[model samples]
Target: MLPPVWEVVGAGQSLYEQGPVAPGTSTQVIADVPAGSYVALASCGNADSTAMWASDYPGIEEILALFPLTSFAIEQGATVITVPAETPAVPVQQSPSFGSSQSE
Candidate 1:
């Protein structure tokens, strides 16, 4: 039998990401990305991101299973990406209605 494969390839870049997908919970795979960046895509749990995954929702039977996690690393010469500072959200206020009555 051949080993399961997950291919994520793009112009000279190689990727083989895999993992499980649990209900209502997201799977996050973090990686160090460098400057002079190109568009990078992240997928949590999906048909395209699994090796031998099985799920009732999508009707897949397991062939070979993984605990559901993957790793990403930046190249030695590439700069790592950083998280931006969070900003507070301002509350929105609505105008009050005049003389309104309702019955159920």
Candidate 2:
């Protein structure tokens, strides 16, 4: 698995660390982001292992079927969308039902 790139959308800022960071190891990256509700993308760059196993599949079409290159090739990385800080509560009214009535 390749290290992922995290991009902050609408902010034009990104953070990345080149790694085959060892399992259980930790790393950090920082980027200045502007304030606003937005999303981020986590791109795993190129997943080289797809071919290592895919080589056994035997045909171009067959390999592609198992491992979609689009998933591995996406440059946009991953996304981190923001949730609205507060949601306004809607005031629901109890509607009155009409009952049968005898009238002149």
Candidate 3:
């Protein structure tokens, strides 16, 4: 069996102010994950800029006897994955500043 596909999703500041999407990003990955138990990490990158970051959500033990286990290892051990520098989700939030509204 193959590992379940995981989709990484989040919202954050854009590296470039004139990009199409702002404060939002997502990605997907497919791996041959085992059925008994395993761990996976999600990586994120700036939509506009090339800078990259990662995060890990562990304890994702899937109990399916039919699945197959493939030897896999992450580059880095378990740790709080780094995400694009953006406004804090809780506690505080920040937005772009505008001098004045443009009249049409």
Q: Which candidate is the best by lDDT?
A: 2
Residue-by-residue lDDT tens digits, candidate 3, 1-104: 32332322223311212224345563344334323333334333455544443332332223111224322233553332234345356764554454446554
Arrange candidates by TM-score, descending.
2, 1, 3
Backbone clashes under 3 angstroms, per model = 1, 9, 5
Model 2 lDDT per residue over 70-99, tens place: 433233333444445566699977645545
Candidate with the greatest TM-score versus the true structure:
2
**Best first by lDDT, ranked:** 2, 1, 3
- Please identify model 1 stretches exceeding 4 Å from their true place: 1-16, 42-104
**Candidate 2 weakest ten by summed lDDT:** 52-61
lDDT of 1 at 18: 57
Clashing pairs in 1: 20-68
lDDT of 1 by residue, 1-104 (tens): 21122311224553335565567856556455333333233333445644322222110112123335332222222222334344358897765554456543
lDDT at 71, model 3:
24
